[model samples]
Target: MPNHPQPLRSDYKYLQPITTRWHDNDLYGHVNNVTYYSYFDSAVNTYLIEQGGLDIHDGNVVGFVVSSACDYFASIAFPDRIEIGLRVGKLGNSSVQYELAVFKDGVEEACAAGRFVHVFVDRASNRPVSIPEPLRSALARLQA
Candidate 1:
């Protein structure tokens, strides 16, 4: 096996709790790979809604995911209470990179680590725009 860099909870600025479903497991009895991306999307967007006050349906500006990648270090199964650690790796004029780590509750090492990039753009025009003040502030708090 290859050595993986495990992430700790202290490394994250925010967290979103998640529950695993039976269907999340595959024949090997662990969560499927695709599910990790779903968790990544949920945790990041939940932060935007709960803390950044972003309106997903009617916002003038929306974030479009342009790039993402994942590295899995461990396995997670159904019935696990997952705690996702989120932090901002970088923020630019109209883009942000979010880093995520998924940990089984009570564990110190991340079961998986991934990143998502969002380009802030005008919803109607689909052109890049400055991140709104509230969104910027919220995102700043997550910066490492």
Candidate 2:
């Protein structure tokens, strides 16, 4: 595998604060690896809902995650205040690739970085659909 350097907070376009929960820690005492993915999902979806006007419950279109990945440079534990930084790496007709980084509060560098790909699809039919204009415009602001 190639060595990927951790990113700095300034590398991202948006930031969302997330509080680590007691349940997020594993027996090893660090935040479980799986939880990082949840953070990624939460940050992305929150942006879509708040800025893109995504109506999760009744919208005609919904985003389905098609791929995801993460790389950790350091451990995070419960009680840590985390800030997830988000940016758009690629935006397509029906899919968007979001690049994310997790920074421990007050830290300048990210402890973890990742990417998520979401494809917009028809809510009922599950067929891929073009990204709506409003959402596309909002996502464009995140481009880095």
Candidate 3:
């Protein structure tokens, strides 16, 4: 397997707690690999909506996820309280790369780490657009 660099809790600027659902586990009894991506999406979107003032429903511009990746370091089962640690890995004119980590609550190390890239675009034309001032300022605070 290719070696993926593991991240620590302190590496992130924002953290959001998540409660694992029973359905998140796979037949093997741990969180399904696909669920990690869901956690990443939830955390990033929560930050964008709450901190960046993104109007997902009626905004002229919205962010579309263009790429994502995850690496699991350990297993996490249902009923476990988790926190998604998030930070901006890169901020560009039209795109922002978010790095995230899933950690069991109170744990210092990550159980899984991932990256998601969002490209800002005009909702009507679906064309690329520069990130808005409010969103850009919010993203800058989390830059790593």
Candidate 4:
């Protein structure tokens, strides 16, 4: 196995608690690897909609996922309360890269670490556009 760098809770600027659902576990009794991506998505979009003034329904500017990657360090199972740590690894005019980690409740070390990159685009034209000021400013606070 390739050696993956472990991330710590202190690396993130925001924390979102998540409850593991019974369905999240697979036949192996651990959260399915695919579910980690959902956790990453939920954490990032929740912050954007709640704190960054993102208008998902009627906004002219929208963000599309351009890239994503994850590395798992440990397995997590149902009934485990998990906390997702989020921070901005890179912020650009039209693109932002969010770094995320999954930590089992009360753990200081991450169980998984990942990154999601979003490119701001015009909803009508589907072309890249500068990130709006409100969103940009909100993202700035998350810079790591």
The number of the candidate with the highest lDDT is 2
lDDT of 1 by residue, 1-144 (tens): 335577898899798999999999999999999999999999999999999999999999999999998898989999999999999999888999999999999998899999999999999999999999899999999999
Compared with the true structure, what per-residue lDDT tens digits does model 2 show for residues 1-144?
327888999998899999999999999999999999999999999999999999999999999999999998999999999999999999999999999999999999999999989999999999999999989999999999
Residue ranges of candidate 1 with Cα displaced over 4 Å: 1-4
In terms of TM-score, how similar is model 2 to the real structure?
A: 0.98
- Rank by lDDT, descending? 2, 4, 3, 1
TM-scores of all predicted structures: 0.96, 0.98, 0.97, 0.97
25-94, model 4: which lDDT tens digit per residue? Answer: 9999999999999999999989999999999999999999999999998899999999999999999999
- The per-residue C-alpha lDDT of model 3 at residue 80 equals 97
Residue pairs clashing in model 1 are: none
Candidate 3: residue 96 lDDT (0-100): 98
All candidates: CA RMSD (Å): 1.2, 1.0, 0.9, 0.9
- Candidate 3: tens digits of C-alpha lDDT, residues 1-144: 328778899999899999999999999999999999999999988999999999989999999999999888989999999999999999999999999999998899899989989999999999999999999999999999
Candidate 4 lands at a TM-score of 0.97
**Lowest-scoring 10 consecutive residues by lDDT in candidate 4?**
1-10
